[model samples]
Target: MHIVIIGVGGVGGYFGGKISNSNQKVTLIARGKHLEAIQKKGLQVKSINGDFITHPFLATDRIDIVEKADLVLICTKSWQVPEAAELVKPILKEDTIVIPLQNGADNAEKVSTVLGVKHVLGGLCRIYSKIEAPGVISHFGHQPDVVFGELDKSKTNRLQKVKEVFDQAGFNNSISGDIEVDIWSKFMFITTVSGLGALTRVTIGEMYENKGTRHVLEQTATEIYKVGIAKGVSLPEDIVDRIMTFIGKQPYESTASMQRDIMEGRPSELDNFNGFIVKEGIKAEVLTPVNTFIHSCLQPMEAKARI
Candidate 1:
């Protein structure tokens, strides 16, 4: 099976490296210094589970150069998915499976708008990781978990095949029975903390330590939950509590990639995360005051960063 990975940052690099090491025909599509580093040396992954290096069958920025791809993992940022979809469209074969492991609720929708439904899958990953260097991924926190399935949430042979590949790669994974709920479940948790993390400029531990801050987290998650439930996602009633417990388990110094991007004066998923909840809330007639507040606070910086 030939697997192609787009945007080889933390998510793509770590998972793609593992798949490549499993001896699959893996191709990495990346650009700039990271691509240079991988082309010269191999992709390096430093993980808590263990460290390993993998030289993919091919690593190039040009998608057209890839002769064939059976599976394409779109690991780009939420906002970049559409553009990535455009670039990788030329390489999509008859049976190529494109799964997006971005940290947002609507990533699959974004990709499908460009690549069509047959080639798209809804997926999300849970891991506190980032690019430690060019072509190097650092998995410093979280037991990396991946959840994915067909957009329609049907049982199929393709789903099982994808699961087998993930099993071989050796990370924690599940073929979600209801991928929408799974995607929103991760979205609820990530959106609950990500915007607040950026606004407060505090680590996950710092926010969890403050009683008042913790209250805000609850409010944020609750607002997001209402929006998701209103949109017919059927998230559990105890989702906020469950997410709070999950946040408590994160490393003391852990910060989400979106939060780190904002802190470093880089463009972030402000629109895709908090801003997304705000938009969806409006569409669903669900109140999202807390999310609106967070989005409002960060819009200027986000706009400036884009400039």
Candidate 2:
């Protein structure tokens, strides 16, 4: 199967490299120095599980140069999903499967709006990785896990095929029975810490170390839980507690990509993360004061980066 990975950052590079190494036909879409590096050498994955490098079947910035793909993995930042979908549309066959492994809750919806529901799948990934340098992915923590499924929950041959491919590539992946809940479940955990992490400018460990900050983090998570529940997502009542325990168990030095982006003065998923919760809360009549506060605090810097 020919696979095209849109946005070869941490998520795309690591996963794509693994797939390509398994002798699958994989094409990577990246730009600038990272693209140059991959073209000259190869995509490198420095992973805790194992480190390996594989040259993809193709790596190019221009989507037009890619082959018509059987699957398109949309791994771009949340804000870039729509435009990236449009760019990759030209290379898609009607039966092509497009799965978005992004952080935001509404990524599939965003991609579906551009590529249509027939070609889109609801998906989320659990991994802590980022670009250590051009064309190099550093997977520091968490055994990579991917969850994906059809929007309508029908068990199609394509879903089974994709799962088989993931299995063949030695990935811990699942086809979710309810993709929406899975997406929101991951969203609840990520949104709970991401904005607060940015605002505090600390690692997850440091944030929890301060009792006061930990309290804020708990509240932030609770607000997101409320929003998820209000949106009719099947969120368990103990989600916040469960996530808190999970957070405490993670590497204390671990930080969300959004936090690092904000710290480095790059545009982040501020609007997509905390800002999303705030908007959903308003629509759902759920109170999200903590999220609003975090979003408001981070707005100026986010806007400045865009300017």
Provide the lDDT at 31 for model 1. 93
In order of appearance, the predictions have TM-scores of 0.98, 0.98
Q: lDDT tens string, model 1, 118-231?
A: 998889998878899998999988899889998887988898889888899998899988999999989988888899999999998999999998999999999988998888
Q: Which ten residues in a row have the lowest lDDT in candidate 1?
A: 61-70
Q: Candidate 2, clashing residue pairs? A: none
Error of 1 at 183 (Å): 0.5
- Local distance difference test values of all predictions, in order: 0.91, 0.91
| Whole-model lDDT, model 2 | 0.91
What's the true lDDT of residue 47 in model 1?
97
Model 2 per-residue lDDT at 279: 98
Could you tell me how far off, in angstroms, the CA of residue 81 lies in candidate 1 after the best superposition? 0.6
| Superposed model 2: Cα runs more than 4 Å off | none
Give the per-residue lDDT digits (tens) of candidate 2, residues 211-262: 9988998999899889888888888889889888887887889999999999
Candidate 1 error regions (>4 Å): none
